[model samples]
Target: MTGSFGATSTTDEVLAGVDLSGKRILVTGVSAGLGVETARVLAAHGAQVVGAARDLAKAKGATEEVRAQAKNGGGLELVELDLASLKSVRACADALVAAGKPFDIVIANAGVMATPFGKTADGFETQFGTNHLGHFVLVNRIASLMKPGSRLVNLSSSGHRFSDVDLEDPNFDHTPYAEFIAYGRSKTANVLFAVEFDRRHKARGVRATAVHPGGIQTELGRYMTPEVLQGLVDSINANQPAGAQFSWKTIPQGAATSVWAGVVAEADLVGAHFCEDCHVAEIVEGVDIRAGVRSYALDPERAKALWAKSEAMVGERF
Candidate 1:
């Protein structure tokens, strides 16, 4: 399974000949890019997909193609969700829980990156609140909906290499604010969430994993200027082996790994691990080439610490 796919593999290619009939998937952030593509491919493969977005109108418009292309009894539905707001997260999770429909997979795919320092509606740092804590509450609230054998895929990023979670000053009140540092902390939280979640649920046959979708020119980078992006690429390239250069992946290729780990790959291969390029990632340290998961991101102790801090921040325990 690992050799069959790589950085260039597209979602359609990874899922070719795979039938997802009777499966129900929940994907957040369907208004654009990877979320839309991931929902489309899953629906096209005969899975019923419930897509969540901050703007339902935008999501409905963006997902028209997903509905049209659905086959073999597959379909798509939309729900309103604003990950930055815990009220909305709880409401969305409550609605799903009330409906009593079990989900085969839950994809925590919505996130923000490198934004000017700000706070979420709940008064926490924006990146940490929205990217990590938002999904943290949402996923944990509805976790019971995922039966044994189900999977949870958190959309983390290579940006995690920048830093690990700062449990003591997660809101940046005592620390100086830096955009990518906050983004890195949030992404690392994403991985730790998956690691701890997998540990908590795996005995029941439910597993969770995080993925880096590769560098893509998506709305996720809307906050970063062209100069900044080029500088980043240059930095990554500078750290690569001789003659190797950094390149962006298309949205399809970017999303391939999420769907691959969610369904196509064996549960044992991906459970509780960080994944990239459609396979489980190696825990490499002291490198800056934009490949491999950072060892700190997968630390069980760090994961547990984050979980406890998240509960305190969100005022709810899973």
Candidate 2:
């Protein structure tokens, strides 16, 4: 399945002719953008989708359209989740565990981007808390529900190339806060989470992987200013030939790789890898390689370390 698809692939295209009847999927951040599209397309293919959002009312209203899109035994439902708060994460996981329905796929698709400095209710840096530790606690709490042959897709970002997790200072406690760096570390944490989780759970027949959905125009960029955006573009293209255009993918294109990861039964994809354009991404060799996994993000030792630290922070060990 290597490079079978590219940035232009649509969610519908990756899933065309695939039957997901009897499959139940859990998708976070399903209120808008890629998450909504992911749920809709999977449901369209006959998967029962349980979408999680911070606001149940908003989720209920938004998922109405997703429910309408369901066909052939496909359906959509809602669950309340606030990833910025540990209590909310536990409640969401508890509710799902109580339901006793195991998911065929769980997509950790919700996340915040480079927002200004702030702390989550848990007193951790906002991005690291919501994007990484939040899912960390939620997943560990409900891991029993992810049975053998299940997939967990964590939505990472190409921004992971920007930096590695500062384990000792993950909350920017003693260091000056930089929004992009925090975001980068969190995204890196996403990849490492999948890595260690897969290593630990593979024998149980469970697998995990992280995905880079490519650049897209979405609310995820709500905190991004023009100056920041231009700086990123300049940094990414710094070594490339002049006049080469930087591009953004459409929403469907952004969701394609995730949908692919959720359903593809390839054993080759069972390990932790940074995926992009529907395939495992290779590191671009240079001073400014922005399209693939950084070595630090995939280090098994670091992954294990992060897991331990996260468990300590959340006061639970899984």
Candidate 3:
């Protein structure tokens, strides 16, 4: 179950010839960038895509854009979801479940990156709350509605290289908070989440995977200073001495791996694998970040522990 696709691949390219006529797909953070492109391509392939976002206006606008690009019109729908609030997640999940629609694919593609220290309405750290816990609860709440062969894709990032999950202080309760560290911890949780989720749910015919969409200039980087952004460019250049200094995929390219995981038949076979550039990435070592999954990111014990803790924190069980 190799998951590799090329860097130049787009959503349409990955979805080519795949007909999703009766499938229903839910993509969070679909208001912009890779999320929008993912929804557009899925809808084009005949999946009834619900573009979930915090803002109804933005969701509607993004849905329209996706609708315009859809070969089969009316395949896109707008749904409200605010990951920053667990209450909102509950409400949205309830609404969807009440509608009696079972989602065949769920791509947890929405997240905040490197934002200033803050907390969700539930008093959890913003990044961990919105990026990890919110999706955790949402998936658990909706797990009952998922029929056999359904898939859930958690959007992780190479930033998992930055840090592992901090069990002692996930909410930064006892330590000084750093934005990048918080973001990294959250992303690492994203990977472990999929790993443990697959462990628990795959036996029931559901599968979960995590993906690192290669760095693209998107709203996800809205909080970074120009110096920080340029510093990343400089670092990439310096690290890849044998290659181009900076390599970035377009939003469509960045979204390809996720879209592929959502619809590709081979995806189920590669459950719990961390993917990047549309493939099961090789594990890397020695702090050189260009290659593989970090040791900390794939710890099965850690994944299970985190899952238990998350269930405790959210007060729910799947």
TM-score of 2: 0.95
Winner of 1 and 2 under TM-score: 1
**Tens-digit lDDT track of model 1 for 88-200:** 99999999999999999999999999999999999989999999999999999999999999999999999999988998899899999999999999999999999999999
Regions of model 1 farther than 4 Å from truth? 1-3
Rank the models by lDDT, top first: 1, 2, 3
How many residue pairs collide in each prediction? Answer: 0, 0, 3
Top candidate when judged by TM-score against the true structure: 1
Better candidate by lDDT, 1 or 3: 1
> What is the lDDT of every predicted structure here?
0.94, 0.88, 0.85
Angstrom error of the Cα, residue 40, model 3: value is 0.3
Ordered from best to worst TM-score, the candidate numbers read 1, 2, 3
Question: Candidate 2 on 113-180: residue-level lDDT in tens?
Answer: 99999999989999999999999988888889998999889999988977789989999989999888
lDDT of 3: 0.85
Candidate 2, superposed: residue stretches over 4 Å from native: 1-3, 241-244, 284-287
Evaluated at residue 182, the lDDT of candidate 1 is: 96
